[model samples]
Target: MKQPLKVAIVHDYLNQMGGAERVVGVLHRMFPEAPIYTTIADRRKLLPELQGADIRTTWMQSIPGILRRFKHFFWLYPFGVRSMDLRGYDLVISSSSAYAKGITVKGDTRHICYCHTPMRFAWDFATYMEGNEASPVLKAAARLLIKPLRWWDRATSARVHQLVANSTIVQERIQQHYGRSAPVIYPPVNVSRFEVSKEPPGDYLLVVSRLVSYKRIDLAVEACTRMGKRLIVIGDGPDRDRLKRLAGPTVQFLGRLPDGEVVRYMQHCEAFLFPGLEDFGITPLEINACGRPVVAYRGGGALDTVIPQVNGLFFSEQTVESLEHALRSLTHYAWDSAQIRKHAEQFSEEVFIRNLASLIEGQLSSRNPAARPAVPALAHKKKGAVL
Candidate 1:
């Protein structure tokens, strides 16, 4: 019998229950015995399914208030991630939006990175700094380090044996930023959990997201308020209070709720409002799975998932006026709920797992002399040293 490859899963952090965490959860389920490596984990915020996994944290885990303040210690990440000893694992799979992909492995070991995007702050510093709440002095300090961080990001990215991007835009980003090619693999949506509501949809539009500056939830609040449309916002983040202040009486903030409650909200909402550029917006796909249409920003990952006049309508610009235009247009069109749900079925969790498994197996098979057909050493050398 062939021995199973020992696998190790690495993620940037485990402090939030978001799309990235859901990817980690699926990866863990696929490799049940594989250990998970992260910078730090907050059990209170992590999914219950992930609590039983063998999660190992690095030295940064001991830093003061690191769980709640990991972003504050960005300078330490390169050192902290490299400190991990992954020499024993035959296959290392990193689910990264940041430093997890930087983990080093022995030449004999294979490393596959499911990249969300090259570190957003390093590649898009100007945009990331916008609407940031950091002190001016701290922001200035960050500005000084951008050069070093960019250099480190590019250098570390080359360490991976293979790269799998979460969307086509991310694939292009990997090529542009790292000078490497990657296959596009969309993020999984748990279509089974969300059911289409039997009743007529509610009068209110909905926005569900981490209330971060870059997410641009403020646009939704502004558009809905200005149009005098009833809107419901469900999420919690640093931007929550500010968003609440900007919201009009027609808008309601529900904060964070249980997944079941969120699903019900998705089912009943008139249309899901997605007014931000995303790497691959899974929420819009999830809303579609619940038989609802989405009003999304036109750029980035939304371009891949939200088919215009099908599952969702796209706003060409990110401004309040542009979103307001889309919302008004949304009212004029009739959406086919069954067809929207069918489009979402293409990106189910099972499809994600199957594609990822096939990709990883292909990497392993290409490495095994007994499994792969023989090629001349010169030919192999010409193909370039396999990572």
Candidate 2:
């Protein structure tokens, strides 16, 4: 009799809900029995889908105030991840943007890492810290840690048996930073949760994202404020105060809202605004699912998802002038909401699960040829070619 594979999942941490965490949620659904290991988890911040997950935390979880100040302990993550006991799992899948990929595995246990990107702080300290408002002393301390962290990050890239990238830009980054070639797998978006609105699009523009400096929410805030366009900004982070100060009378900040409320905003907005570069921006697809177009900066993952004049339009530069031009150009473009929504459906949750499962089964078959027949016929399936 063929035995079932013992699979376990590893994530950098479950301290916040975002696109990466959503990817973890899809993974949990795919391998429901798989135990999830992480450095720490903040229960209050867990998404609804992850509320009942079998999450196992490391020693870092017990540290006082770790949940609130996790970023301060970045240096300890490699040690915490390395300390995990993953000896028995037949397959260990790590969803990492950082230390989760550094876990130790031995013997026949194969490790597959779904890398969101190389550690940004270590690899691109200047841009990662650009517009960051940390104390000078703290910034100095972080700068000192970058060189050693980069070394450790590069050294650990060799630990994984296979790597998966979320977008083409990230795939290029993996090859550039880690000397590894990874197949691109577009992450899942729950297209069904959104519906094409029956009502006509509203006059106001919308932005839904974590207000971080690197994300450049200020671009959206400033562009709208300068144009006297009504812009609604949702989500919150350290960059809120500065962004609010940049806002004019027409710009509104709604902070964090429920998913349903967010969808309501997406359904009625003139268009969704994605001003920052992302590994993969899921919110734009969510808005597209709501039958709306996006106006995004032309770079990073946006290159993969945004089909110019089809689903969304793009600005060439990250500057206020470029974005302002795109906003001005938006009024002249004729947008087809149904076509936009159709494009988003290509990156649905079902497609992601099918592609990922096929990849996993193919790897398993390659590892044990004798058990090939016992696996599903999907072993020959290819990664997502949607891009």
Candidate 3:
């Protein structure tokens, strides 16, 4: 019998849990034997599913205080990624938003990069620095590094055998920045975790996101305050204090809550508010799974998931006035809970796995006609066969 193909997964870092880390978790489940390689992994911040996985970190992990202040050592990540030795793996899949895709792989190994977006700091310096609270000296240093980082980021795109984008906007970015076209694969959402609420929707609006400046959470707070609409803000970040000062008495900050409690909020909220322009926003779909409509900014990933008057409404501008107008407009529409939930089911984790598995298998076959499958054929399997 032919030996099974050796597979490996690479990510920029595993220090924080977010949509990117969630994608890595799904990738780990798809290829259970594949060891995950990263520059660093913060055990305390790793997701429950990733705690038991075979995670291998680079020398950067040994650096003092790297976990708490990884961004301060941004210039060193490319070197850290290059230090990974992926020689024996027949296939390597990189889940990257930054330096992971720059990993040096053997010529024979097929490297597929599931790019969340090209490194935001490199390609969109101003936007990346907008809401950040770095010191003036650090900010100036980062600005100087941006040009060289952009060069490195562009050069690394050619290293991957195949590129997969998480959204259409990201796909466009790949073409524009790297001169490479990538197929769009929408990120997965665990729709099964949420259920349509039997109870009537609550009066307050909801915002579940990291309280970051670029996220534009301020729009939600300011708009709700001006309109005197009750708003519940979940998740905490560096921008928390500024947002709290901007918020009115009607706005409440819950900070971070357990996933179960978040689901309860989603199920009960009159409408979920998404004020940021994300590459792909998964939270809106989570709320949609709970049969709640979303009021979101019109651009970015929102274009791909939210169908106006179907599952969510969109504000054309990213300002408080525009979002407030959309919120007011939401009251006039007749939303069908069942229809909203059905729309969200399309982006479920199962669909993502099947699509990604098929892509991997196809790439492996094309590379070596007689080679064994790199990923199991989850698309053709019966229910509960490989999940």
Candidate 4:
């Protein structure tokens, strides 16, 4: 009798989730029978499979209200990720925008990692360090964690047998920051859900994203106020209520919209606005798939996905002034629906599944042998600077 391949899927905290969750969702579709392992799965609200599926969680799972009350708890993720048991699994696949790839696997098990980035807070420390010097104690704590976090990131990344990144930007970050390389397998964009609307220019610009501090959605709201343009803000998070209060008369808050409705709005809108420094933004691709032009923050993943004066325009900074200039500049541009869709098709969910499947199959086929207890080590090296 032959043994079936036992697989374990690991991820970081499933609490303050966003694009990472979307990537995991597609991974779930691809490997439905695999057991999901994570630091915690917040039950307040989430994709049903995460809560209903066979799940293994760490210490954070015991804590309630993980979404609202877990500020000081992010420090637990690296240790929490270590708590997941992968003893008997033949293959371990990790979906990480953060620390999920750090899980320990059996010496005999093969590990494949799909990294979003090499842990944002640890690598992009400057973003979170501003104005953080409130006290000697707090400063001391940050000082203590910074070096350890960087050490942890680098140490665990080497444990991965192979890595696939969602964007070239992230692949470069992995190499520079983690001394690791990864192949780029772009995140899945479901082009089928979005149909091109032939409607003329609409009344307002639309921005759909989780309202995080880093998202910089407030810049768009401020720009709409100053420029006197209408803006529709969709999606909800910790920043939603505060953003609503700060918004001027021109901005409308539509909290936590469904994907279908968001696509419908995207097709009819004047343009879609994205203000974050994304690693690989799935939403911008979805908006372009809907045949609307994107106005994106001009750094990170947007550099790869958006071409100026084509499917989108890029603002130079995360400020109202830059966004206002970009929106004002949009009036002179022309776009072709076919070209936009063509650009988006390159990152469709189909391509993601096919590429990911091929990578996994290729690795397994090479690892397999007909008679073998006498096989040499199988090195799953990166094909094209895998990060």
Q: Tell me each candidate's TM-score.
A: 0.91, 0.93, 0.96, 0.85
The candidate that wins on TM-score is: 3
Per-residue lDDT tens digits for candidate 1, residues 28-140, read: 87777889999888888888779899999999888988876667788898888899999877789999998999999995688999999999779887666664567889988
lDDT of 2 by residue, 1-387 (tens): 756668899999999888899999988887788899999999999989899999999999999988877877888999999999999877899999988999999977888999998998898776666656567899898999998999999899987898999999999999999999999999999998999999999999999988878899999999999999999999988899999999999999999998789889999999999999888899899999998999999999999999988988999999999999999988887888889999999999889888778678767756756643344323433464321
**Model 4, span 349-380: residue lDDT tens:** 77787788667765665564552122112233
| Residue runs of model 3 more than 4 Å from their true location after superposition | 130-133, 371-380, 383-387
Error of 4 at 348 (Å): 1.7
State each model's CA lDDT, in order: 0.86, 0.88, 0.90, 0.78
Residue 289 local lDDT, model 1: 94
For model 3, where is the 10-residue window of minimal lDDT?
371-380
Name the lDDT of candidate 1: 0.86
Residue 176, candidate 1: alpha-carbon lDDT: 99
Displacement of the residue 130 alpha carbon in candidate 2, Å: 7.0
Descending-TM-score candidate ranking: 3, 2, 1, 4
Error of 2 at 262 (Å): 1.4
Order the candidates by lDDT, highest first — what do you get?
Answer: 3, 2, 1, 4
* Model 2, runs deviating above 4 Å: 126-134, 371-387
Q: RMSD for all candidates, in order, please.
A: 5.7, 2.9, 1.7, 5.1
lDDT for model 2 comes to 0.88
Question: Where's the lowest-lDDT run of ten residues in candidate 2?
Answer: 372-381
